[model samples]
Target chain A: MATKKPKIRTMEELASAIAVSRPTLSRFFQDPESVRPATAEKIRQGLAHVDYVPNFFATRMNRRASGLVGVIVPLLTDPFFASLLQTVELAALEMDFTVITQCSHGSAELEANAVERLLSMNTEGVVVAPLGEYGSADALRQLGRSLPIVFVDSRPAEPYTTIDFVGTDNEQSIGLITDYLCRTGAPPVYLGMPRLNSNGLERESAYRRWMAGHDLRPEVLPDDLAPQSWAFETYAYQTMDALFGQGLYVDATILCANDRLAMGALQAAHRHGLFNSRPGARTRVRIAGHDDHPLSRFMTPALTTVAQDIDTIGMTAMSLLASRIRSGKPGEETVERTFPAALKIRESA
Target chain B: MATKKPKIRTMEELASAIAVSRPTLSRFFQDPESVRPATAEKIRQGLAHVDYVPNFFATRMNRRASGLVGVIVPLLTDPFFASLLQTVELAALEMDFTVITQCSHGSAELEANAVERLLSMNTEGVVVAPLGEYGSADALRQLGRSLPIVFVDSRPAEPYTTIDFVGTDNEQSIGLITDYLCRTGAPPVYLGMPRLNSNGLERESAYRRWMAGHDLRPEVLPDDLAPQSWAFETYAYQTMDALFGQGLYVDATILCANDRLAMGALQAAHRHGLFNSRPGARTRVRIAGHDDHPLSRFMTPALTTVAQDIDTIGMTAMSLLASRIRSGKPGEETVERTFPAALKIRESA
Candidate 1:
């Protein structure tokens, strides 16, 4: 917004400047015929006196075909998001849609700003993986009133009941891994990720439920390092190092919430000389994770994890949003589309 | 874009329908006052009959403050690019600019399409990491003529001399690592990455220069596995596996083009049972690389590499773009801004 400041700063001021009601002016912008001809004309005349980009808003409001969709993610570094965005982009391209992308980088304030930015661009719909725990519900609810939005990855906590969600069924996936670990070896000791969103809690709860079902005690590790941090690798590495200071796990089986944390746990094991032996060295630690990361197989001891099917999640999110966009309304009933995660057997566990 | 199809399809047909020339219609849309009042009125009347979204273009053309800058990169899978995008995004936010992002996914056609998408959004400026060898020069040149464009990570060859570039000084950084390898151990056998961009060739040349300076013959490996693929790890893994099949390298030291490649090479070594020994085991193969990737430090024995200041490159690119945007003109003289890379010695080498 490098343009010179308008003498009238806000829409309230502009509405007052023209002696027209704010709602009426807003209505005129949305569609000139929605307001009386005299009111619409007054709003137009007022617009002529301002340097603000109301005309841009006016143009967006008048269009029936914006040919654009916005995609907002917490961060691109998460391999999973990177893959999701790529899949969505290809799907968008096929539908003759241009994707405008913004990363919130896990900041709630920035996430809100990203929504505002997308609104200003007049995106027809949005597919966003919101900052689950830290998000502002009001901002998102406000957006839901005007445009169709499809949530990917972790759906935020309640009060977001109206938004469609497409993600891994954490219950089934985490349970699958937990079952596999128990069947093949000692029951797993749960290693958690930062409570960035619902996934952290959802995944851990699944592990605890499985343990309880099996009549075994769940060893859920307390976060001793960077709690609530997205730096999964560093967090896991440091937390694992501290755990080693106490002693090795009695079960010698670890199940991390995600593959990234597993990667770090392995690195820490290597640092503490636990990885010096072959993975099958009987007493060596067996670690597994979830969300088969792109590099999981390439890890020192290839990671054993659950695959979340990002392609399905991404394509499904687009399909759901497109239907809403085509209908030109937010759906009457929001739906949750969950996919199962498959167990990927690798060297680590 | 989902609106009822208009009776008139193409703009050319619309121009003929309205009994006006195409260029005149284009000029009118760019600025209605640029054409005769009657002609503009006729064009507006014709538009009322169509479902096309011409007003969106008109609004962008009429504005001095789009408040938007675009970023197009080849892919987000690369840790370096991921870090770079994050930096630029934060910098863009600081400037009160919203960023529109697109990924080329290493396709020249897609890169061109990304440019078109940004143009239609009427971005004030752009920071792009182009598909170096395969990029569409004409598309980028056209964009450069209209708005300031800053290149990051890699600069394309001829016909792109006009765009400002910010990247690592590969010669200094590559040479620094080469010297360290030579002084501490045997001269390194060069392992090249896919020549996806300029950095690929530049780093290799720098390595060659350092070897020549020391009066040693450089052994650049043949790209037997993946010549131009972006899947760096798999490529290096397969290539190194083939090399290992031919017996171990005589030098016993490997200098990879980037840390990702080194990672793959390391995995291949482990697969071949060469990585099972301790680093101090004199006969153990030594591996080093460039571009200290985010995960380089956590590699089994850790990776020794060079660091490109992504924070500086990203911030500098934004500053250059801001100045050009402020001047309302692409600078008359294009300049290359390169930062020297620092050596990050870890256990691998």
Candidate 2:
């Protein structure tokens, strides 16, 4: 016996059967709120009858803007950025915006290209974590004039008066951690990144200022030995290994730039037979870091760090961008907001 | 003196300046290969003279297909998926394809929504790490009929003959790690997840099979203790802590389903004063895991794990999808490719 094949329905037929114009049907699928409730209901009912799915490309062609937002980050593999992205995604979804995230892989060129791509898409807005020193100011400025942009985590070195910025209070966070490290143990030497982003520079300055305020000598590991790549753990591991090999900073506290660096230092200390306990005979080194990475708690001795309120950051950035998108004004005065960080003391320090 | 405003050029002006149609200019921005070399070069020179970026939405409206490929994963915060995503993105870029990645957050509904969004974007193809048992087969089947799909890490429960799949050889990997653990120390207790994905189920089965082959009783951790959330580390930490409080397996080795769980177990052991070294008086617990997460090497004892060849998986998946897209055949026979996992023996075991 022969079986009958299912009938295929075209989008035009579906729209006609639903008794609505093609543009209205397209608008309904793009966003239900776009079409009138009665027409949207008719389209929905018709959609259930036919196995036809609207072609997104064709629907987007009719619309002036796709209800899409672009989020560009310096790196996605970093737990800090990963957590931040998650928070932002949830927030964007709640605001009825679809987010398309892209990673720059720590390259300035890639960052610029990402912006260009987002611009091409006619994205409603963009939330970016700029590659501080390496980012292109001209490209950002040009793009900023065309759409709403919110800079998160770190702002561009050459600030544009029209761009919104959201980030943690790095100076205050660093001061809090440094004060704790000094009071609980020996004064710490600053181990910092190679100025990859503005946050590192702020933290380094804060560490120096705090040490000098306490009438102590300021010590920072030189940048000559810093790794040129974004693998901060490897850089910290090698730096600590070389420093330990020279019998430097034994029984001294070290304030790492971030949790990943602190993790590597802890590993280096463990390999050197140095215990990381606070009150033990085997204890040899004290360590603290900034940016309470998600995995910090799982570290062997746990880690002492400053926790950035990522939820607040994500919420603030989204709110600012949504407002800008609604206003659609490019000449508005820029707003910069900073959330304070909290200290999380654990066994490491 | 007031600054002189820069002249704004439109797509029409640029096209006329380059002596080409607007459609050709749009095609050049979408993909350079779509236009003849000489015309593309002429358009590039015209673009260099003007500070204009093509409207991607408008350009996409004219094209039959967007050069965008969708990549969907069960979770984005997990380092395993992050690593796999990085590999896939780089490979896709090499193939001149733009990648749009979305995370399902381990929810089948979210997975279906993600596929719907991709369909709306008119994505050329999709590489998905499905949500396993919870995923909607009907939604995937509908998407499969429209474009090529390559499943990564795990395949769907209701298999379709036209879809391609690429993943790690779970049985071989688990067997290799289990044999090493048994040979080196006490036969390890199996620590498994709540069967969120097929990988966990396969690892659990492989552990039981190996134990039976050795004529030993297999011990699998009960799933009742597993957390309902995707936080594997917390789940493992709580499970290990509870078992330790009961004085169960005080000195026995453990084989975790994945590295995140192993990390949690390691942290719990440290809290209980059980060291993780091969040749030390303080050594008490020996633990191993699978899927060598990026941070696993930075662990104090350096995790011993089965390293899934994520690069191979990404490359194979992309290659298969690209070929399928080129062929444009939904009725073609499915292809299944498995890359062998390597046992990385480190200090933990």
Candidate 3:
């Protein structure tokens, strides 16, 4: 018969069993580097031998900052946000913090509920990709008063004027994609995104501005998607399919607000007998998009789009939140960091 | 002029201000349904008017369950896992438990670290999509002994034989895809996934077994991708690109382990001057894959694959974990729930 092992339940008992002073054990838990690595290794091996885990409840009871942070995004099913959250988690781990993630699923009520969850978790700080105009200002202001917060990807309007933000410059990105299309083929017609988010409104205005700068007439397509809908693909497919019988985008290029829309446009084009960008056979309907989504490169004709720097955005937001937590203050002067987007020219445009 | 309101910082103060007994306020926080709707409304309004959140640490300090659950996955960047996690989070939210997510990013070491992090969080329970053969068995055993754990999507070998699991029935799913291809065209050649996890190994064996059942020779292409690399797209592209001049899969249908691989195969096929499944200019290479991934429908020659019911898998896993947690026992006779995969036929095969 196997012998029942003696259970070590507390840190003090483990320290005593391992023949180390309690303060040494405490310091090692606080920062392993505070003790020699040999001692640290001994502690680690001892921990492996027993089921004893350092109690996190003690940290919370002491009214000390829990080494927990938070992140809120609109949807995790969208590959773009999924990839961004992955990057943010990697950065958080490197900074020795754990991240609690929430997906609002594109609902204002859910977004507010997520804020309450963060408050309950006692998160040291948070990074939010706000749902633009649909977000609850009261909930956000309450949260802002309590903890360090940084916004990423999408911007919220005033009186969040002093909030820290990290994102791609839509004006520069839209201008770059628009200019590339004009140089390569017909001046692109703008296939706009849903008007719920700031990016949708900003990108359309940027496209018009770029066309104005070039002294050309901008044919703005319908911004007809319903409010708060994240289904960009369905919207683009429906819009393009409805217009296929009339002109098929040959007279004007189709520049989508994002790569997902371009993917949908490609699908509609394929269904309507507009072939691919193969060497021998190709479609005359040149299309472009922004945000170089993960599946963009796998598209049949591939997508020509602007690429946002997710690594910089994720790491910067984390580092900013880290500094704020370290300073132990709320409502610091706001800072903004904008990254320029780079054009990726593929077969489509 | 707006008058400055007195701050009601504690639960007792808020209860007094709202003219509710302390027990009523506590009951409302515990379960709003325990109180009258009108009383619940009053409490909700009071919470909204003030920045007072029920302290989670109080529950922890009482040595009560924290009402926090955890989820561990191999990668969130993979859309399959992203979609599955999204479903799991929804179920968790419905159960009124907050979820903390950890992505191991396909590393066994990271998976172990995540287990340790969960231990520190004192999670009531956790649902893990284990990293098949690459998972940390000791860490998992420790976790299993400490709390309720349910594995999803991938299976781990014994001494975990009795652990609760939810996944697609691989044998049935593989047979369906293989039978479809054999019926429609030349018997397919299997493009294997990297041998890092159980799904990869199980899928290949399932294909071989199905071929044996049909009395046909199984031609499994090399499972040559390096260990622990999640770059399935690049792997499939390189494999297909290398074999381009050697016949271009015309003699045999190319059946990939999953949709992402099939997507890559399609891209390589397109790059090699082979056209798409758009009406007239179709290529002779017929490709099929498993796992009707979210983007599988948008693939140029949209994928024909097996659809695992993620909603059933996710909800089943959560409910199992919830029961286990409610029972307050570390180990019980484990249960396994397997859902049959349905065939989603598209243009690819």
CA lDDT, every prediction? 0.82, 0.82, 0.82
- Tens digits of per-residue lDDT, candidate 3, A1-349, equal 1454456767779888777888888778777898999999998887766657676655443345778888999898888898889988999999998899998888788988988888877789889988875456667777887888999898764457568888889999998888888887778898888876678888989999999899988877774544456788887787888887565574358899899888888888888766634454443777888998887998988888999988888889899899999998765678889899999999887
How does each model score on TM-score?
A: 0.82, 0.91, 0.89
Model 3: runs farther than 4 Å from truth?
A: A1-5, A8-49, A61-63, A223-227, A248-251, A276-283, B1-5, B8-50, B61-63, B157-159, B223-226, B276-283
Order of quality (DockQ): 2, 3, 1
* CA RMSD, predictions in order: 12.5, 3.7, 4.6
| lDDT by residue for model 2 (B1-349), tens | 1453433446777777778998887778778999999998888776666667776656664465677899998877888888788888878888988899888877788889888888777788999898785457767877787888999998776767666889998889999999999888889899997577778788899899999999988999854645556788888898999998787766888999999999989988887767734354543778899999988988877999999999999988988888887788844887889888998999888
lDDT of 1 by residue, B1-349 (tens): 2565465535578788788998898788666899999889988888886744343334454466677899989997777888888899899989988788888888888888788767656689999887875457767766786679999889765446566999999989988998998889888998998878888888888888888988999988764534778898998898888888787672289999888889889998887778675555667789998888888887877899999899999999998998889988795788789999888999989
DockQ for candidate 2: 0.69
**Per-candidate clash tally:** 0, 2, 0
Error of 3 at B166 (Å): 0.1
For residues A1-349, what per-residue lDDT tens digits would candidate 1 score against the true structure? 2454356545678788788888887777667898888877777887776743443444354466677899999998778888899889889888888788888888888788777767756689999897885456656765786689998998764456576999999999999999998899888999988888888888888888989988999878764523668899998888888887676662289999899999889988887777665555677788999999888888888899999999989999998899899998795788889999999999999
Steric clash pairs (candidate 1): none
